[model samples]
Target: MTTIEELLPDDLLETLRGRAAGYDEDNRFFTEDLEDLKAARYLTMLVPEEFGGHGLTLRQASQAQRRLAQAAPATALGINMHHVIMGMAYTLWRRGDHRLDWVFEDAVKGEIFAFGISEAGNDAVLFDSVSTATPSGDGGYTISGTKIFTSLSPVWTRLVVHARHEDQLVFGFLDRDADGIEIINDWDTLGMRASQSCTTKLHEVVMRPERVGTHTPLGPNPDPLVWGIFGAFELLLAAVYTGIGERAVNLAVEIVGKRRSHVKNAPYAHDPDIRWQIASAGILMDGVVLQLEKLTGDVDLVGTGEEPQYGGKWFLHFSGVKGRATEAAKEAVELAVRTTGGSQYFRRSELQRLYRDVVAGLYHPSDNESLHASYAKALLGPVRE
Candidate 1:
């Protein structure tokens, strides 16, 4: 029952916000913020109570992410990768699958888990991988491939990766210092700079059999693992972007209320056009947050032993939510920037940073194009693949 409000005390949240600009300016990882989060037990929020965590449900965790994001989007997002993987393991364990219990236990004990599944041009999503997972005959796998956008690159203790093994798509965690593991710190980017989501190269990195978690075939299937990952990742990601939108709207409101219009001798908030624009952003943000609450709340209810009512529809909903929320967040940020005028374009402005950060959402899975294609398939029946 530990809310984000409790975990991130007001003073800590202020300190984090105060440092966000410095981290973004240096294009460095939010090392100080990460340590603060760890100390606050934010990293272990989703782990089970028996494992020394707050045992927050996914719904609660999603809210926590949103609140954290409102303070520091990049920090919240970078750490969200860890939460997504841990949420998956804990969820599976709660649903009577104990295979990934070790992952949850370690996470609760303060182990940092980083996501390492994305690859260049491998848009098969989770169904396929460009990396290879060659069996080492001792039941282990010798993984050899590069993973791009590997978040938490500098400090991950365990990396959850997905790669191909003949016809099967293998997935599991590996020690950060495992042989052949290399981290390339070339994370210069437009937004989420503090995330330090860099490139991870694996040159025949070896993983023990115990480390390999799941092996599903290379295509769409009715695997709960797939559902769990997609659900947690998409929903939590949406929440983070939504937080950005929320913050942007609030900032715009504050700035507009203080800026005087030269002709009218009144605040910009008095202008009908300015009020309408900020209102539109607020409305869009409201819709995104409502959608997140609806979907995550449903998932929480389903976790109580009932059949998954959403089924495949869950993924569709997630895709829609993620795509829409991201777009909405981007729109909100853009509006905030416009409302603030030329002053926000500077590197020192938080709105400028947020505007860039929101763009990163467009690159995540369920991009606008992909979401449209899926919607077409869902609504009008599938075209020839």
Candidate 2:
């Protein structure tokens, strides 16, 4: 029964909020925020209690991530990469797939995990990889390719990556200190600047037999590992953006209550148009909240030995939730910006930073086009050849 309040107290959140602007301005990693979260053991929230973690369910973890995002989206997103890997491992283990048991054990020992799946020009996503996984004579693989958007680059001890091994997609873990691995310090971005998601080049980096995890076919398939990854990644990503929307709505209410409309001789909160904008944002957020809750709750049930009957609809649920939440967040932030008046246009304003951060959601997996296509295919079969 670990509460989000206890894990991220008001004082800690305030400290993170206060530092957010500075980190954005300097484009540096949230080192202090990471230290604070580590002290609270936030990184191990998905690990079981026996492994020295909080043993939180996916629903609880999503709620905690939403709370954290309210204070600092970049920090929440940076730590989110670690949580995604842990969540996948936890989900698989809960379903009696102990292939990733070492993930939980290593996390308890304080080894941070990072994602290294995204690549340049790899539109096939998890189904295919631009990187190569050449089999070694010793039953391992030598990976060589560039991985973009490698979050937690500054602190991760282990990196989970994927590459193509002929007709199969190979997934494995690599130690940060492994030879032939190079981290490029080029992560300058429009928003989520504090994540430091730099580019990592693997020059035939060796992954021992024990390090390799799962290998699947070249295209989409119903592998449990794939299910675990999609479920954890989409849900957690939605949680973070939904948090941004929540923060935006709160800021709008606070700002409207304080600012007065001279023409109306009253606070902006009393103005019908301003009130309508805030209310509209709230209405949209209400649906987003419900969607997140329902989806996360369903995933949690799977941990208790409940069989998921989603079938192909699981992808629809996963991508649909993320797509809706992110787009709604952008609209909510826009409403907040419009309601807050000219001051929010300043670079120093929190609303301005949120405006920048929210856009990054558009580029994440299951982009709008892909999401819509998935939904269409689900509803009315795939496009005929």
Candidate 3:
């Protein structure tokens, strides 16, 4: 079996790491990194072998993402949106639904897919949409709405989007050159700047009948499409943050080994307080690894003809792991910065860059507020009216 290390070799990672600072500093899209990844066929990792891809499972793909993130987080994150779309299609196909087979086919042909689901005020996410999808008199739909945080916008050939169609929610793909679609290049942010996840506005864009994927009832249910999206999205997202934590811990260890304490006349690694902080960061990272392994392994078991039971706790499982991973990653990064002292505060320091990038975790879906509310509802049932 080909490993992630072989695919994303040390040389490639080093090259990416070398350019990370420049991308972040200039707030530019990771154009060079994207080209490198494309040459390596990283985008089609989840597509099956028969489709001319590596045919890696979600577990393997998540591991690959973690390694890529350790090199350049923004690069990994920008590409992650494409993998998430591929993973969702793979999830559906694994369960004998071939409606999304075209995703794999297009991916093999090098068509990049961008996620266009987020809206300004729509917190319902995946369950409801503020965008409207009106019938276009020929079984297709004319979608009109704005989608925010559209990663891979600079290069995506196809965009997967969803909109409200009366009582049902419609999912479809829009070509980049399609009429009435506009990509706003306003991706300036505090961190993850290289992702270039800008805002996309749809002015009654037409989605052909063949491009329409799935339709589900409003307000969440047991739709396989929903499960596919949540499953691939949450786990893959957690992997990126986990990689950030791992990088922070590794950097801290390296710094401690080389820097000596003036007060103690010895390396900071010998100091009990520094050691404790590093150890705490490692422990938090370990918990995230354990959670990722269990969840991703269980998800991959479907390929072996064995379905792991979640007992109606699937949402909690997915969202909860994401919440834990992101929080743990943020805390771990903090501890690392503390151990490294004042040097990490400088803009030139990689640790400082990691610090800024990790802050974006608090903003992703399954946020603290939603996670807490979901946990409460899961444990005690929905609240009284």
Give a tens-digit lDDT track for model 2, residues 1-385. 6888898999999999999999999999999999999999999999989777899989999999999999999999999999999889888888888999889889888899999998988876777999999999887999999999998899999999999988899898999888999999998999999999999999999999999888899877878888788889899999999999999999999999999988888999998989899999999988998999998989887756575788878888998999999999999999999999999999989999999999999988988988887778778988898
List candidate 3 segments past 4 Å from native. none
Model 2: clashing residue pairs?
none
| lDDT tens digits, residue span 1-385, model 1 | 6766898788988898999999889899999999899989889888888878898888889888888898999999999999988778866876788888888778877789988988999887788999999999988899999899988988999998889988998888899778899999899998899999999999999888999878899876657777678878899999999999999999999999989999999999999988889999999999998999988877776557664576567778989999999999999988888887788888888899899899999999978888898889879988877
- TM-scores for all candidates: the values are 0.97, 0.98, 0.98
What lDDT would each prediction earn against the true structure?
Answer: 0.88, 0.92, 0.92
Cα error, candidate 2, residue 139 (Å): 2.1
In model 2, state the lDDT of residue 27: 97
Evaluate residue 152 in candidate 1 and report its C-alpha lDDT on the 0 to 100 scale. Answer: 90
What's the count of clashing pairs in each model shown?
0, 0, 0
**Candidate 2 Cα misplacement greater than 4 A, ranges:** 303-305
| Model 3 Cα lDDT, one tens digit per residue, 315-351 | 8899988999999999999999999989889999999
Alpha-carbon runs more than 4 Å astray in model 1: 305-308
**TM-score computed on alpha carbons, candidate 1:** 0.97
Candidate 2, residue 211: the lDDT equals: 92
RMSD to the native, candidate 2? 1.1
